[model samples]
Structures are given as structure tokens and as C-alpha cells.
Target: MDPLLPRPVQDLGHYRLPSWWTPGAPRWRQALWLLVGLPLLASELPGTPWRQWLLRLFGAQIGAGGRLKPRLRVKCPWRLVVGDHCWLGEAVWIDNLASVTLGDRVCISQGAYLCTGNHDVRSPGFELKVAPILIDNDAWIAAQAMLAPGTQVGAGAVVALAAVASGLIEPGVIVAGHPALVVGRR
Candidate 1:
């Protein structure tokens, strides 16, 4: 197996799409996403009410009453499962190189980054490791917060603005600063 491939591909003998489409699919999916999805989402940005329809049309598992703004980048919409009453703010990136599950009522603020892929240079060629991210219900990830690969944010947690979390953040807690350690909570 080629070490240049993703870990899943190397181990499973199959290839997933380039973080923007379904596995073994073509570039057309990505194009359609850009053309159709982007336009629809953009159109609904100013509370136009068309965003939900567009996201559902593009195969996002968005729950009822969930509002997603335009410019919300989703890498592989198929790998995303967002729950009910959630709000994904403008320019929020859900870079689901693997599966990313957001539980009910999760609020991913503007400029928040949820990334699930990394490079493993230990291999012959630098291989990619794409893990899943889980953000539990009622979580509030502030602006510019970064949730790194394989991270799990528990329910009702608050990741402060500009914070970077590469690991798990406990439930009902508040995390701030670089590398995102617990600051305080109730």
C-alpha cells in the first residue's frame, strides 16, 4: 500500500474522497458543492430561510430547526451529522476529513475551526490521519476556536474565543487560551 495515502485508505484498501465529496467519487461533486451549495447557502445568509433547504439538498444531516449560515465550509458533507436547533455561524469550518458529529443545540461560532486531519511523517511518505470529532449537545465554541483532530467536546462546554484545543474538553466547562486548558466553569 502507498504510504502517501490516508491511514484509512492504507488500512482499508479503499480511498475516500478528497475531504469534499463522497468516497471514490469525482470532482463534479466538489464542483456541485461549490456551485449549488455555496450559492444556496449564500442566498440564505441574511435570514433568507433557503439555507436549510440547500443543506438538506446537498446531503447534510442537519436536524430540525438547525440554522447554518453561508460560508460554512464542510469538508465531505456526508461525514457530518449535526443535531437539532444548532447554529453554525458564518465562515465556520467543519473540516471533516473523517466523521464529525455535533450533538443537539451546539453553537459553533464564527471563524471556529473543526479539523479532523493531520499528517503522519513516520511513514515512507507523509501519510494522512483523519479522525472523527465529537461535539456534544449545548456546547458553545467561541469565535476562532480550533478543535483539532480526534477531539471530543463534552456537553454544555464553552471553548473561549481564539482558543486552540487539540484534545478533549470536559463537559460543562470553560476552556481558554492556547492549547485550550480549563479556565473555569460551573
Candidate 2:
């Protein structure tokens, strides 16, 4: 079901159930993401091809001059979108149970995890919860940072090392500390 479809068209398109759309993501893609992610996570050095292959195989909209380091682990590879000139550094785990969007020239440094899913502990079913994470162009996520669910990192923003990003990081600013707070201009 296309999200933007007109209501009448949506209703007429056939009542396609969610179960029909659900499937384990492509195996080849999973292998690719893991192939690149494991080495980057375990090793001290960088492997560009491995990372690139994974991103490409998983259908990410990665542009030329992009460098995804080996340590990045991306779940549901098909849901990730990375733009041109982006850099994903070591130990970057993107748990894209939902969607994770990265704009052009974005830099995600070492040990940064972009988590998009959580458990709905409040519900009796204890189901998996999800949200979208958006990082705009020219953003820099420094070493060991974590971006929580539904958070948006604006353009030209710099999130400092070891920061925990919970909400929105405004555009053109520098942020640091847990639940990252605006610090200065980027």
C-alpha cells in the first residue's frame, strides 16, 4: 500500500494484508550487511568495499563517494537510505526495524548506533515497537553516539562523541552529552 495514495484508490487497490507484505528480508542482502558489519565491528582497520557491497545489495540509495566502514550492522537493509558522500564508521549499528534515512555528506563516526525499534513494555502483548530516524545532509555523528527512535538530526549539525540523541537536534548546531543538547554552531 503506497502511503500517499488517495483514500478511494487505496480502498480499491485491494485489501492487501500486512502479513502478505511481511517476509524475512533478502538473504543475499543480510549476508552482505553481516559480511561488512562483522569485520568493521571486530577489526581495528577499515574495509570500504565490504561495506559498499552490503549497502548496495540491501538497496540503500547510496551515492558515489560514500564510505561505509566494516563495523556497521544494518537490520532490514531494504529500509536504509544513505545519500552521496556519506561515511559510516566503525561499530555503527543501524537497527532499521523501521526506516533510517541519512542525507548527503552525513558522517557517522565509530561506535554510533542508530536504533529505530524498541519493545512496547507497556503493552500486554509486549510487541516490538518502531519509529523512523532521519539524519539530514551535512550532519556529523561523532564517535560512540546513539540516536534513539523517531529522532531527527538536522542539516549541518554535529553530534559529539558518546552522546545519546533522544529527540531532535536542531540544524546547524553542535550537540553533546546524553540525550544530546545543543552546544554551539557547527
Candidate 3:
């Protein structure tokens, strides 16, 4: 018996795709997103305003005074809504298979990932699941923080650096650590 032997079965190793799968956009829009939209936004050539404009052109609802840094990987601009005076730092990845809404004054710091999609482990075919992520007004998702699907950060809440947040973070609470426990209140 080899210690490095593989598991008898792996759901994802031999998974099959569902017949009804789609990229959530029409073929033309997906082509444009892949060809032009993602590349432009990921580049440092565009200034903050131009980047915002580009995202808007691809159907993102962006509000005033947004400071968007480069190297962002946004899965679908159509599923995103960013509010006034929001700041998104470099390397922020929005893997929004579902909707992601950020309220006014929200700040998503560097290297933060907001993921709105996951795969179900129980299913033999590895079924995909998606849910919306909501970050309310004045909330701060600190650097390197990872927000899981269906996570909601309430108004004035803070998800500290390197925190893995899921479920609801109550208003004005500061959460930290994996599975993000409430550490303080703002």
C-alpha cells in the first residue's frame, strides 16, 4: 500500500458539466468581456475614472468618486454594483457568479477577494452554487480578506485583515480570523 495513493473517488476529478450551464451572458457579450473588457480593466494603463467608465460600459452600476486600482479580476461586470466614494485596492478579485453589491463609502482593501460562487461537494457531478454578496455603507473589508458567497457585511462593519468572512456580520461590528468572529464594535 502506497502512502501517496489517491483516494478511491473524487467528485471533482471525474465531474460532468450540467447541460444548462451558461456564462450568465449572451455569446456576444461574453466574447467582448473576454476580448476587451477584462484585459482593459486589468491593465494599469487606464486611470481610475477611465476604468470606472469601462466597467460601466460593460454594464456595471458604478457610483461617484470611485477609486479603482489596477489588476482587478472581475468575473462579470453586469453582476456588480458599486456605490459612491467607494475604494477598491489593487488585486481585488470579484468572482461574482451572482450579484455583488457594495454600498456607499465601502472600502475593499488590497488583495481582498469577494467570491459569490462555490461548488457543492456532496454532489457527484460537483454542482455549482451561487449567492449574492452585500457590503453595506461604511463597511471596510480589510486587506487579504476573503468574503464567501452569501456573506453580508452590515453598515459600518469591519472585516479585518486576512479574515475569512461568511454569513452576516452585524452592523458596526469588527470581525477577524477564519470564519470571522466579532472582535469589537465600531
Best by TM-score: 3
Ranking 1 against 3 by lDDT, winner = 3
- Whole-model lDDT, candidate 3? 0.91
Superposed model 2: Cα runs more than 4 Å off: 1-46
State the lDDT of candidate 1 residue by residue for 18-90, as single tens digits. 4542342257876888777765564435662566666666666778886677677776776788899999998
Q: Which is better, 2 or 3, measured by TM-score?
A: 3
Question: Least lDDT summed over 10 consecutive residues: which range in candidate 3?
Answer: 1-10
Model 3: residues >4 Å from true position, as ranges?
1-9, 13-22
Question: Cα lDDT for residue 21, model 2?
Answer: 36
Model 1 segments beyond 4 Å from truth? 1-28, 42-45, 121-124
Best by lDDT: 3
- How does each model score on lDDT? 0.80, 0.77, 0.91
Question: Roughly what TM-score does model 1 have, to 2 decimal places?
Answer: 0.79
Pairs that collide, model 2: 40-70, 40-71, 41-71
Error of 2 at 30 (Å): 5.2
- Count of clashes, each model: 0, 3, 0
